[model samples]
Every structure is written in C-alpha cells, then in structure tokens.
Target: MHVKSQRVFTRLTQLKELILESDLFIAEYNLDNIQFVQHAEDLLIPDGKSLSDLIGEKKFRKIHKIIEKSFKVDLRQFEYYLPLLIVNIIGEAILTKDYHLPLDIFLWNFAKESEKELDGVETYASQQQIMQAIKMKDQLKMVKDISKRPYIYRKNILKMAKWYEEESINLLYKNGKKSLGKYKHILLKKRNFIMADRFEELTLNQKSFMAVGAGHLAGQHGILKLLKDKGWKLKAI
Candidate 1:
C-alpha cells in the first residue's frame, strides 16, 4: 500500500508539472488557441448480436424493413449489430456529403515531398486494441444515443468547420472533450500520453513536424501540455 501510494504521488506530481507548472514558464505559448482542421473515425466492433437483441423485436422489425426497402441490404447478416450499422451509415452519409481526401493524406504527401522520415505515434493495430477496450454493450448504447441526436451531429460538424476556419483550438478541445465524456480516458488521454512520450523521444533526435487529430491538442492530458511538461518550448505561429 505504501509503495502504491508513492507511485500515485509521483504520478500526481508529474501531472501537476504538466498542468500547473506552465505559470512559471515565460516561453510557453497557448497551442490550444491554434485552430487546425482534421478528421477522425471510430472503429466498430466486429462482433455483434441481432437487431432484435440490440434494440427491440418490434422496433427492429420495423427498422429492418425500412432499411431493406431503402438500401436493399439483407439485414440478417448485420441485424444483431443494428446500432453499429445505423451509426456507421449515418456517419458515412454525412461525411460523404462533405467529403474530400483526408487532410492527413496531404500532410503525409508533403512530408514525403520534403524528404522527411515518416512515423506514427501508434499503429493501426494499436488503435484497434484501444478501441476494442470499450465495452461492446456501452458502444451499442452510445451509438443508439447518437443516432437520436441528428441535430447534435450537424452542430458538431459545423462547429468543427468553424473551429478549423478560425483556428480555435480551445473551442474544439472543449467540445470534443464534452462529446467523449467518460470515454475520453481511452479515446484521448491514453493515446495522448503515448503520442507525447513518442514525440518527446523523436524531438530529442531531430526537429520534427507532428500532425495529429486536432482533438489530441487540447485538454489537461493533451500532447501540448505533455510536451510543455517535458520542457519543450511552444511558440504560437
């Protein structure tokens, strides 16, 4: 117990340095104010039950009928995971309407053109593992809830576009954190910590330009704060 307490204390002290110690640093600029445009997507669990098991028998039947008529898909293969299907379909539709090549592709291309070594903080496999950590039932519930919030989805997309235009990192951070809520621990903080540690290591060897999802730039545990804690200087450009 004493040893555990010591470890906890050490972690808390480090966290304090990242969050509260910035007051003493004159060179630290607010990276959260820089608005960057980006995009991200979530992974769906491969395993799911029937639509009736997920939603309800009557509602599932009604929804399945509607979906079949509309999209002509035989839902039996996916009926068990109706929530996941619904959310994914909705997400794709929205993204399609506003779709362009992902910004990261351009960034990657630019880096290649510049003859810079390319690296990623985490691999696609690691990201999948992180996403798989979410409870499947909770994932279903979240998607179902999201499906009911069309206005919120529209609002979020508009907010993202506006933030990108204005370079409002703080507003993007605030909204993204709110949207993730409890899951932010997995989706944002954990990934941010890993990325920050890797970034610190890379910067030690050479100057590097890191482009990541905008959501990873804000909040207490965000990469900017993590870098600042490591004594890296941040300048607003």
Candidate 2:
C-alpha cells in the first residue's frame, strides 16, 4: 500500500480500517516477539561485534560525527549504532506526539497480537547494512527537506519501484564507493522469494493481510509477483 499522504491522521485512519477488516495482520517485523529485539541487536552489533568492527573504525567514527552534528546525539553514550539511531530520530520527527518513540512502537500498539513478523533476523540485518552503506545520507536529507513545498517522497518511491520492477543492473554504491550490486540482489530478490513462500504457507487455509514495504510489492522479483506465479489470486483492496 503506497500511501501518498502528508497527513498522518488520514494514513492512520486508513490503516485502522484495514486492520479492523482483516483476520490476520502481517508485518515486516513482529514487535510483540523477542525476535524483534534480537534483530535490533544484530543490526547494531552483529554477531557480538561492535559497529566499528563491522564498518571500519574510521568509517564508524565518521558516521558518529555526522550523527552528533545532525541529530545532536552522541554515539558514545548510546548502545546502538548509526542506522538504528537515525531511524529512531526520523520516526520521532515525523510521528511526534508529546514525547518521541520509535516508529515500531506505534505499529506495535496499533496492530498488537495480530501482527506477524516475516523477515528473518539475518536478512533484516543485511538490509540495514545495505541501506546504511548506500542511502543513509539521502534518507536523512529527505526527512530534513520534507517540509518543503511539492513533496517528492512519493515520486521517489514510484521511481524506485520502476527501477526494481525492471530489474535494473545499474551499479550501486556503498559508503561513496561503487559496487557490482551483488548484495542488493541477494538481500532483496532472494528475500522476496522467501517472504512469498511464507505468505503462501500462511494463507493456505485462512485469510491474511500482508503489509510489506512498497518496494517489495511491484518488482519482477517482488513478493506479489512470486505469489501470483504460485497461483494465488490477488486483488488490491
């Protein structure tokens, strides 16, 4: 569901209506389970290694400086790394109400027990690294520039959908260095198939409402296409 809305209330209302109409709610993560915390830890300190070990100590310090300058948060005091902290800050800025909270907290409260997490911890960790390597600056800029007239967030989402849907082989970047994009292929295409397989298994005997990011819905290797190939009839509501 690609919601092109500037109003949070409208989006929440639409989401609430869908949840009330559905039997089961599926999400990218299950906030109610222990696995969510496990995934969070894996992203911040994978395999019990610090952020400096995953990305070089130099790069980690650079990112730490950037965070300190941009968000006024010092990494030395926080247990988590840059990616998780940036996500929390952006979620708070966009979803503010009296006090700040992680975006997952709102989703957890909204859907409660009906929400079932889909992606494995390893896959989630890999995607977070890929995002941090490639688009962290652009993401932060988007949030900073969000209030400007003629919002481009929805347009950028559509453009990315087209790129993924067509399976474009353009070179991707990691921390300002160009790469062959192999990680994206494995993390995105393979994970789509995995999610599709799980979705099919989940819906074999009952109705289910699967909610994934927009990028996972329209690609040639996307979950929706994978499910359709397996003979599941889908109709957008």
Candidate 3:
C-alpha cells in the first residue's frame, strides 16, 4: 500500500474496533450504529482531504454520495468527510504486513453480506401477475383466497416476506458480508439470483462496500463463512 493508503487502512481498522466494542450495548445493534460512529469531521485531514484521495477522489466521493442517499444521513458540504472514513478503514488493515486484503474480496464480501440481510425477494411475475388477473375485481380477502390456487401457495407468501427482508438488508448493509443459506433449499435458485443481483454494480478486483441486511450475516453458509472458504481473511475491525 502507498503511504496514504496505509493511514486509511489503519483508520478503517480502528473504526471496526470501535463498532465491535460498542455492539455489545446495542443488542446486536439496537439502533443505527452509523449515528454513533465518529462524524466525518473526526477523521481530520491535512489541507482538507481524508485518505480516500489515495485511492481516487471521484470514486471515494461517489461511494459516499451513494451512501448519503441510501443511509439518509445529512452530510455537510465539508469535503473531508468521506476520505476520512476511507482512511480510517485503511489504517486498520495496515496493522499487519500481510494485512493487504484484496479489493475484490471486500466488494464480493460486501455483496454477500448484503444478501444475508435480504431474506427473500419475490418473483411476482411468476405468481402475482396471474393471481391478480384472476381476481382483479375481488376484495382483499377474496384476492388472498384466490391466491390459494395452485398459482400461489403458503410457500409463495413465505417467499414474499423473504423478498422484503432480503431487499431491506441489501439497502442497509452494502457490505455484502451476510449469508444467504437459510433460504438455500427453500427458495433455491431464486436466492441465488438475488445474491448475484446485489453486486451487479461490481466487477472483478473493484473494491467497494455492499450494504446488506444483518440477519443474513450469521450461519454456516453466510457470506463471511463463504468468503473464508474462498480464501479471504474476515479480520476483526
């Protein structure tokens, strides 16, 4: 890593440490942890630039811009905020000489983590379209009753909820570290499709965060475990 990158990696690690340390009080995250983390101003810069500059200013800013909208945080016009976050994260990784993690690893892991949070995503075209057409004029209960036809099942209802959950997770985490194994056998290929969709924005070797749902982060087939199996270190902070 370059001199600037080293600093950013170190800070990233420290940020991780802070989150892990504080998660104990949050009930596996009782509230939005981002609000509690250091503000952008906290990651001071010289001449006003955080470490994200070392990577690429546009990329750094773009990531933050995406986050600002998704996270709904009101970041100020202060230019240093995003770079500081990147620098701090990079600093954490520099603790060990071998701590240089692959950019693809991070991006891929982020996408995976994201899917874990999205429990299920619906294939409405496959079911809802036909079901709705059959009962276009029916009342809510009547529509639901018609859904019981072979076109839809208790299984379909389960899938709808899963879709909502998984998408929610993806929107939040963007880290892609969560797992999608829970729905593996139940939803099978549908689950696979969502995981792949989460990182369509990514390419091989590009490093980026993938905000996903927290519920997807645990379990044996989760993103963390999957990444470890594929040979990437899921370091603490």
6-113 in candidate 2: lDDT tens per residue? 322334566667766666666664545545654465445335555455556786677666655544555555534444454444333332243233333444456665
lDDT of 3 by residue, 1-237 (tens): 122222224345543444333311111111222244345233344456443553356654654454344333322343354332332232322232333442223322333444422111223233223232322222222322322342333333234334333434343222222211232332323333344344332323443333233434444545555555556666743
Give me the runs in candidate 3 sitting further than 4 Å from their true place: 1-184, 187-203
Q: Scored by Cα lDDT, where does model 3 land?
A: 0.34
Best by lDDT: 1
Model 2 is weakest, by summed lDDT over 10 consecutive residues, at 171-180
Clashes of each: 6, 0, 45
Q: What is the lDDT of residue 208 in candidate 1?
A: 59
TM-scores, all candidates, are 0.65, 0.55, 0.23
lDDT of 1 by residue, 33-144 (tens): 1232111223323453455676678866665565455444445555544353455454434432321323444334444554556666766556656666767676666554
What are the lDDT scores of the predictions, listed in order? 0.55, 0.49, 0.34
For TM-score, candidate 2 versus 3, the one ahead is 2
The clash tally of candidate 3 reads 45
